[model samples]
Target chain A: MTKELLEGNFAMAEAAVRAGCEAYFGYPITPQTEILEWMSHRMPELKRTFLQAESEVAAINMVYGAACTGTRVMSSSSSPGVSLMMEGLSYIAGTEVPVVLIDVVRGGPGLGNIAPAQSDYNQLNHGGGHGDYHQIVLAPASVQEAIDMTVLAFELAEKYRNIVVVMADGSVGQMMEPAELPEMRPVTRIQGDWPVTGNVGRPPRVLTSIYIDPPAEEVYNHKILNKWYDIQANEIRYKEYYLDDADFVVVGFGTAGRIALTSVRAARAEGIKVGLLRPITTSPFPFSQLDELSKRAQGMLVVEMNTGQMLDDVRLAAKGRLPVEFYGRPGGMMPFPDDILGEIRRLAHTPLTTEGDPRKRWMDRVRTGELMLR
Target chain B: MQTEIVFAGFGGQGALFAGQIMAFTGMDAGLAVTWMPSYGPEMRGGTANCQVIISDEEIGSPLTRTPLAAVIMNLPSLDKFEDRIAPGGVMIVNSSLVNRQPTRTDVDWLMIPAQEIAESLGNRRLLNMVMLGALLQKLPVISIEALEKGLDVHLPERHRKFLKPNIEAIRQGAAFARGELTVEATPGANGHEPEVIPPTSV
Candidate 1:
C-alpha cells in the first residue's frame, strides 16, 4: 500500500472501508465531522450504506438497526455527542450487538470548545452507559495507529459481539499525517443464524435487552461479565519505551502518551533515567503491566489532558506499590514536551539542564559516578 | 533534522492550506510529517493558524511551541507569531497586507509582497501558494516538484483548473525571492499607490 498524507478522520473512514464496514451512521460534530463527510462520499461510491442522522441519538439507533442484521456498522461523534448516544450504547451492549463507535473527544462537562482533549477518559472507559456492561476502548497515538486500531475495532466488535469504541482526540481527528492505508478486505456476505434477515425458512431471531424474568436477566449479566473477564485476560494492550532499565516511569495514554513519550526521550537525553508506559487499550487498563513496571521503577508520573481522571486507574494498577503522582492540564489544553520533561525531572530528583549538550552532561555524571542510567 | 513551522493569517487567507501543502509535500518526499490546525469557532471568521512538523525521523509530539520557521500572511498573525520563532530561525512575511516589519534580530527574515503578486496575477486565492514559494526558497524543506505533486493530490477535480495558476504564482514568488525578478511600483487594487519595496532578506 502507498502511504498518503491523510487527515485522521479521513484515514479512519478509509480504514473502516478497508475493514469491510457495510454501513455508517453519524451526526455532524467538530473534529469528527470529516469522518462522516468523507464516508458520505466514499460509502456510496463503494455501494455501501451511509446516512446522516438528525441527531446523535438517531444516529446510534440507526447503527443499532444496521447491526441487527449482522452487518458491519459504525458511528462517530465528539464528547457531547458521545453523551447523547450513551443510552443507545447501553442498549446495544445489553443486546450484545456488534458495532463500532468512535469518540473524537473534546473538552467537556457541557458543550465544550472543539479542541483536542482526553477528558472523556472516565465517560468512555468506565462504562458511560447503564448496566454492568463494558465497551472495548482503543486509544491510538498516531495516524497510522488510528487506522490500524479502527480496523481492529471492527474485528474485535464482531468477535465478541460487543460495542468497540475508538476513543481519539481532536488532534488525531483533525491532524494530517502520512499513513499507509490497509488493503481492502474482500467483501464477505454476512450469513448467520443470529441476524433478523427473513424468518420464512427458519426460526426468527429477536434481539432485545428487556427481560421480564429476573433470573434470566441475571444469567445474561453473568454471561456478559464472564465474557468481559475473558477480554480482560486476553486483550490487554500497551507500549513501553526505555523501560528495560529506568528509575522513573511516566504513564500516559492516547495523545498524552505520545507527548510523554517524546518528553521521556528528551529527559533520557538529559541524563535522567526516564521511561514511558502508554496504555493502548484503556478498558483493559494494562493492570499487570503497570504492576510489573511499578516493581522496577522508583515511581510513576501519570499525565493527562483532563483533571486527573485516569490517575485513579493508574493508582489502582500500581496497587499501592509506588507513588503515583498526577500532572494535568485540563479544559482542552495539551501538555507540551517541555512541561512533561520538567515534571519528569522534578519527580526523579534530577537537576534540570536547559543549556549545554545533555549527552555530555550524562557522560560527565557517569564519569564522576554521580548518576546511573537505570 | 526536524523543521517545525507555523502558518498564520486571517480565517480565509489559506494559511491552513499552506501548512497542509507543506505536510503533503513532506509525505510525498517520504519524510515524516504532521499538520495540526487551530480548529474551532475561531476558524469561522477569525484568525487561523496551523503547526507543521517535517522530520527525517518519526515525529514524537505533533505540537511545537517554538517553531523553526513561520509564514505570517496578515498583521494579526505577525503580532501573534512574531515572538514565537526559535532563535536563528527564519520567518517569511507577506509584506503586501502587513505594513509592519519584524524587529527580531536573531532570525532570518524574508518579506515578500505575496498578496500583491497574487493580485497582479488576477487571483488572490493564490496568495498562500506565493507565500509557500517564498517559504520554500528560505528553507527548501521539500522540493518544488514535490510541492506541485502535493497540490495535485489535495485539489479535487472540480478545482483542477486553478492548479496551473497556483503553480505559476508559487514560481513567480520563488523567483522574486531568488532575485530572479524585481518588483515595480504599481497601483493598488483600491486605486491607492502601492510601494515598490525590494524583497527584504536578513
Candidate 2:
C-alpha cells in the first residue's frame, strides 16, 4: 500500500489494468497520450489486448467490437478525438454493450489547443452522439480521484450495461500526485448467456443497434430510459466542504470544483460564510442536493472552465429558488483561485437577484474589463 | 501550513524534474503534495514551468497565482514570474543566465550562479539541483537529508552516475546561499577534492 508519485494519466491507465481491463484501443491525443503509452506496454505484459488504431473512430469501433465479448474494454482521448468517436458511441449505446471511456478534455469547438478545460462538460454529460441516451459521467478533481474513478467506471459500465465516461480536464490528466493504486484483480469475463463467444453449445445470439421496426426501437429506447432512471436514483455522487452554517454555496465539478474550494476557504477566512458542492458524478448530478441547498443558502455561485455549460445544470437543480451567479473562463484558460475568490467576494457583498440571466451578468462584467484586473 | 513554489525555466532546464523532486521529498515527509506542469506544444527551447504545492492539509488548487517561493532559471522565467512571488517569500534566481537585478525589494532574493557551479561540477544539467539546494537552504520546508533521500528514490537509474556530482553541486549551492562559500571560491577553483558524501538511507 505504498504511495508513489503518479501522473493522473498513468495512474488511471494502471487503475484500468488493475481493474481487469481486458482490451484497450486508443489513438494518441495530448494530455492523455500517456494512457495509451502506458497501456501499450502494460496490456501486452499482462497478455491483454492493446491496439493503437489508425484513428479515434477506428479505436472506438474496436472498443465496440471487444465490448460485445462481455470483457472490460475502453478508449481514452482528448476533446477533438472524443468527438470523432460519437457515432461509434451512439451505436454502442444502442447495442447495449458496456464500455469505459476516458475523456481528458482540452479546449474545443474544433481543433482547439491542448490545454486544460471543462468545455467538454456539455458534450459528455448531455449525449454527445445523436440519441436520447445518457452516459454516466464521472468528473475527477484530482489524481487520486482519477485512479479511483477509472476503476469505478469499469464496474459501473458493467453493472448497468451502459457507457461510463471518466471526464477529466487536461490539468488532472497532466498533473502528478502521490497515490496508492488498487491491487490487481484477475480478469473476469461475464459468465451470463449474453456474450457472442462463438455460441458453441447454444443457439447463436445476435447483437445489433439496427431496429427497423419503429415500435421495437421505441421499446428499446424506453428500456434505456428506465435504466437511466435507476442510475439517477442510485449513482448520484458529490463532495461537500464547509456547508454547515453557510450563507452562500459554490457549485463546480472536476478541476473547477477543486479550484473553487481554495476560493471558498479564502472567503471563509475573510468572514464570509461560504461553502462548496463538487459533483463527482456529473450525469446523475447532485440536483437534489442543490435543490436542498438552494432552500437554505442565500445564493449560489457556479464556477467552470468553460462559458457556463454546467451553469445550466446548476440553475436547473436550483429551480430558481435562489439567485445563482456564474463565473468561468472559456477556451484553454484555467481560472486561478484568486479569480474565483473575487467572484465569491462579489457574491457575498452584493444584493443578488434571480431575474436576469447569470451568464449575461457575468458577460457584462467580462465586457467591462473587470476580470482583467485580477 | 502550506507552501507553494514555482519552478520556471526553459524547456530543457529540468524545471519540471526539480519540481517533481521537491514534490516527492514533501510526500516522503508525509505531507500532501501536487505537481502541475504547464504543458502544450512547447519544444526544447520553449518556456516551461511547473507549480508544486506541499501542504499539511488536503490541497485544493494545484496551481497558484502568487507562489510562496519561486526558482527562476532563465531571464524569461524571471521576467514572467518575478512579481508573482508573495511579499516576504523567497526567490532563487540562476544568476549565471539572468543578468538583470530583481526589481522587487520585499522578497528575499538569492542569486546563485547555478550554471557556473554545475559546470564546475562537470555537468551543466546539475544547475537544477544547485538551485534546489539554494532553495532548501533559504526555506527548509523539507530538510536537505530528505532531499538527498528524494534523489535516491526518484532519480532515474540512467542518470545514477551523476548522483555524486549532483549532490556536490547542491552542497556548493547551499554553501553559497549560507554565505560560507562565494561564487568565485567554489571547491574545484581552490584545488581541493570534492568531498564524497555517504549514500542516503532508505
Top candidate, metric DockQ: 2
**CA error at residue A158 for candidate 2, angstroms:** 0.4
Q: How well is each residue in A1-374 modelled by candidate 1, as lDDT tens digits?
A: 78888889999989999999999999998889989999999999999999999999999999998889888999999999999999999999989989999899998879988889999999999968899898899999889999999999998998889999999999999888989899999765466667787789788889899978999999999999999999999888998889888888998998999888779988998999888988999997898888888788787888898877788888777777766666776788887888788778877883433334333443465469664222
Off by over 4 Å in 2: B185-202
Off by over 4 Å in 1: A189-193, A350-374, B145-156, B159-164, B184-202
User: Which residue pairs come into collision in candidate 2?
Assistant: none
Residue B172 lDDT (model 1): 84
Place model 2 in a CAPRI quality band.
medium
All candidates: DockQ? 0.68, 0.76
Going through the candidates in order, what is chain B's TM-score? 0.89, 0.89
Question: Pick by lDDT: which candidate is best?
Answer: 2
**B46-79: candidate 2 lDDT, tens digit per residue:** 7788999999998999899999999998888999
